[model samples]
Target: MTTNPQETTPNDWDTRSPDVQADQVAAYDAMRSKCPVAHDDYMGYSLLKNADIKYALEHPEIFSNKVSTRHIAVPNGMDAPEHTAFRAVNDKYFTPDRMQVFEPQIRQVVKSLVSKLPRNEVFDAMDGFAQLYAVRIQNVFMGWPASLEQPLIEWVEKNRRATLAGDREQMGKIALEFDGYIRALLDERRGADAAADITAELIQDVIDLPQDLGGPRTMTDEELISLIRNWTVGELSTVSACAGIILAFLAEHPQEQDRLRTSLAVGKTAEIAAAVEEVMRLQDPLVTNRRVTTQPVEIGGRSIPAGAKVTINWASANRDEDAFEDATTYNPHRSQENNLVYGQGLHVCPGAPLARLELRVLMEELLATTDLIEFGGANPTQNAVYPAAGYSKVLTRIS
Candidate 1:
């Protein structure tokens, strides 16, 4: 139940269960406050304190992202100079200008989905509202055929299974299937050679790596397919989870909902943004991010040797008592500039702005239309392993 700073290691992480991971993070917070930095060969010498986390994030040299736990783009994998290059490929798509262009489309997507809900009927908001909306938008962003939506849902499920199983053959088979699908899309875009969609823009993007690390790095066809697959894996499940969690919290706290409604009356994005942040804090979509040490390093005066794997307890770090007041309680207005939900440093999420926009807009639309959303059936249970936190079903009545 308690994490001893001197006891845990990088190798101790459970890659399969979010509940178990959450427990580990909770335990780590106990030690983080006292030790700040600690050694655990199982955990790699992790710097758990807020100060240490900031340091580790900012100083990518000491703690690298080159060998990522997720086998995709180097965005979350590669550290420093190289990280910047991988990030740039999709950076423009998530920029303010692009977000402005995508806003109407995103709003329309949410609106259409919400309109389809039966009047006064109970439905699972997580499945009906969150996952459906997020998946549709993701498809829009990826330029995938609409027909593939069902396939995508299946793909995400199968991909998660492969990842947890560590089945490379199964993973590769799925990846090839996706690649063929994307390649056709790529070919279509190339054939038209006209106005570019976000996916097309990414395909044509030439990543310019820093000279110090290497020359310009272009995303190969396979890499592009992998990146899109990774994006599908990384973005959809968490966003959907967050969407449901936000609504669930709002449904439970009518006063907060009233406050949010009042703010929306005046068209204040900050109010909704604040509420979303709190949801993010409480929901903690991603339980952990893992890394394998390439070189031995000393942390908290203890040395962690090379080739060790470490888990970044994001959920724990965000809730560290040292970092926030009443870390366990949900406070909508707690607007700190740094929240680990999107991550930190050079490897911060490239799609964060778009994701934020998606969340903010989804909330706004929901609040505007629905007066009340109350759970109708059994309490929703989340997936224990893959996708970390999300409802298997969340039946609710729209008022």
Candidate 2:
């Protein structure tokens, strides 16, 4: 194995530093300008520029997604033929048709949650609304009962805390806790007559494998748990963060909020969706994704050898001035053709269609039901640290 000489260089930046954690996007932007390709022990190589991130994502053969050997992450943690097959199975659940059918339920879930918010009063949108909406909608989508809501919410918090602390042991225990929840659901579904729901369908789904490794086969309990866990991560973490970000953006930009509220009232789904995407692009909900090098490669004028861990800073890439003109400006009309919000290449987020639907429906209901959404109280918005994006506490008022 070739050792990367650059690894000996002192760290360019500390990702876990309180300064970076306080404002990840700003810190990354600074790094992108100074050192687009930075080496660090925590993230191996942090690619901050749009071009560098795009290059890494496009050339997944060199930058493998199998960052960890311990856990299986279904399609996300796989590459090539394996990723392709698993992704095929993963795509079936988030089809446009499935989203269309599921739209009303999502809206119903959002509406129910939105109605309960105390109008004209301050509330932590993250905990008070976004998290609740994310968990409830996920339960509805997965066919889980309402009883699992609180436990899942608590689990998400614990998982986030462990991740922030870089506590592998705690993360493993939390993963097992999550597996236990899904395992029970799977067992219950298997024993009873197959119900008409996503979870039930997943329980019966199978992936055909090449004859060399193994022929066609059903997904093992472990595989099912991993797949479900991936979905939950999307729903519980990214989606929830997106909720807080979107709400906070609207609160900060009342004019844009007014525009969306008007657009939504007239049933302008495309307009609302575009605006949501743009807002998310401005303040991305997802922070970073990991990739490990399979071969020596050069990126951003730096050489990295095989086995180097790479971190793709999505939040920074989406805001790269080289990629988008006036990158920070919120313009729904701006071309998103190169936006890395859902990512690119084989491993792009499969849950994007569902996430878009959820965000749009939630925003539409939020705008339609309330006259305004503005910052509440005198408390300043508190941004979530590394490993999480958006606000940790977004105090907002609706009237």
Candidate 3:
């Protein structure tokens, strides 16, 4: 319960400080030990400890996810009954039956990307495979065209830079640009016969709204666009980050990579998936999620007034020593019951099932295809800053 001097100050820690941006995991680790419930202007109260985060997640009533009044994030920004309805629509696309059918397509996407990589040559895995794999799979899943791939990748990069810069104007412009792309797709769908894909299904999906606002009705174009945007973010950025993180881990940890490769060879899909989860747990892809207090709350021995912004640092919480033994150590068999990799509670990522399936299939193909994976060239790996995780430039050699 050590109180930080900066806790009462305006900005406890600059979330975008050079040191933090350079290595967010280490910065968060330091914060967890020094001030688990730290306050700063950017992210009002950062809950670094596992306990505090778990409390925040379990009690969404106190810590609402409605952090933004400007933007609509589909179910992610909604609460309770409204969230439940929209979430039902969001969840419909990621069902087990859908994933079962989507598995081979995802595998083929991975295989096609991996096959193109030059053996024993130094290449940036993030650019060479991870980003492409993510974008390609997302397009295929959503029934988007191949032409959208490069533009989408460019959009993600610009959006990340704009967000990091805190350039609201640029961010808004970027959002509008993305909306243009999505709206075009939507327009195309509207004019033609209904396509057989998730995007088409979502376009036609209806939700039963409560009597207060409106009854059962179809979502407006704006709502549809917002929902797709949410899904796109999940698919492109988070998935890309996961791919890079998993591949980077495998490249560095040869023994574990070999073990995983062997496991995959023997058709041990579950084991492979567990290893992917563990690796990602050790180095999470998605960084933090925002929640604001609905009422005054006490967390990690710090009193937070009502309406205060709260940031749940998944990067820190997943590795909290209090919640996990040898938290930093990479142990695939460790129990993930308490792991918040995909998060916890009501706002937990609805795309978890799809993400897991994609990662598992990608890893399986990667391991089965390559004999050895190791650091490439002489370039140092460049870690992505806040709002993003994992290596931005992962130079690796696969043969």
Best candidate (score: TM-score): 2
Q: Report residue 335 deviation for candidate 3 (angstroms).
A: 0.6
lDDT of 3 by residue, 282-330 (tens): 8888888888888877789888877677888999998999988999998
Question: How many pairs collide in each candidate, listed in order?
Answer: 11, 0, 0
Q: Which ten residues in a row are the worst by lDDT in model 2?
A: 1-10
Q: Which stretches of candidate 2 lie over 4 Å from their true place?
A: 1-7
Q: In terms of TM-score, which candidate is stronger, 1 or 3?
A: 3
Q: Residues 1-399, candidate 1, lDDT per residue (tens digit)?
A: 744433545443333445444444455556666565544444445556555566667766766676544565546666656666777775766779878988898899889987888778766676556766778999887666688777767776677678767798998898777778778877777765644676777767888976775677667876777677667777877777777776677666788777888899998879999888877875577766666555676654556556655556676677777678887687877756557888876777788898889989988988889787666766543433443563445566778
Name every residue pair that clashes in candidate 2: none
Q: RMSD in angstroms, all models?
A: 4.7, 1.5, 3.2
For each candidate, what TM-score against the reference? Answer: 0.85, 0.97, 0.96
Residue 87, model 3: Cα distance from true site in angstroms? 0.4
TM-score order of candidates, best first? 2, 3, 1
- Mark the 10 consecutive residues where model 3 has the least summed lDDT: 2-11
Provide the global lDDT of candidate 3 against the true structure: 0.86
